[model samples]
Target: MTLYPATLLLHLVGVIGLFIALSLEVAVVSRLRVAKTTTQVHEWLTLSRVIDVLLPVSAVVILISGLVLTFSAWGWGHAWIELSLGLLVLLGLLGPVINGPRMKAIRVAAQAAPEGSISPALRQAIFHPVLRVYVPIPGLVALGAVIMMVLKLDWL
Candidate 1:
């Protein structure tokens, strides 16, 4: 019956969008392990077009909406909010420096290889340590944030 409910709904949408992007990254890249043929690599890389826009846009929306929810109704001092905001900062960093570069490396390799010359090293780069670690970080943090919201834990 008030702005809180609407804002809450929007916030949920952003969360869903953010998770969807992360999930897709995991799914598509996992599939890459079995992927063969340069054309197939190109197709897999094409999946990025969907993710590239979804992640940042959803992140921005979440950040803006969270600020609104924080200042308007949820007090800034709440333990859960502070922790969630801290997780958000970590989330913001993960996409750009960690995941983004891994994806770009894959893209560059996919583009650089001669036609039909998809190599094992190229695939290894795609499944690099950074990406393996990076993929789950967002989802795990989001789940942690959700747990804090549900439990409403106190600041420690």
Candidate 2:
């Protein structure tokens, strides 16, 4: 197969993986919100860390494949491609700077405390304003990028 088809396939698969990861995050967050036991919190924290690893991997695949696509045929000068690239970069920056450290702190707290009851610190971290604000941005931005790519919507 050609590089274009291969890269497009990779990009599409990456988007699928990222969407699944995002959905998992949402479901886990929902569980965390209603978690009443330490074990529940701990489980969610562990899952959060595990999924964090996978999430970034999918994102990187999407980005690298998109880059490959751009250089091959999409071209950097096209406004739609540029917008999609911009949103992907935004999401790439958003996750590490925002969600990563916050999740780490929660995981640490969960690990330190006994597996009997959920700690206030852990709960607060899960509900932290900064986390709450940034957690959904990447997914939303990814969705926007997908929309722009699919619809070829270029304002410029």
**Candidate 2 stretches greater than 4 Å from native:** none
Clash count list over all predictions? 0, 0
Clashes of 1: 0
lDDT of 2: 0.79
Q: After superposition, how far is residue 48 of candidate 2 from its true place, in Å?
A: 1.7
> What lDDT does the true structure give each of the candidates?
0.82, 0.79
Estimate, for each residue in 1-156, the C-alpha lDDT of model 2 and write its tens digit: 989898899989989989888877877777877888879887776677657777888889988998898887867777778887777777777777877788787777777877777778877877777876666666787787787788887665
RMSD of each: 1.5, 1.6
Worst lDDT 10-window in candidate 2 = 131-140
lDDT of 2 at 123: 79
Single out the weakest 10-residue window by summed lDDT for candidate 1: 112-121
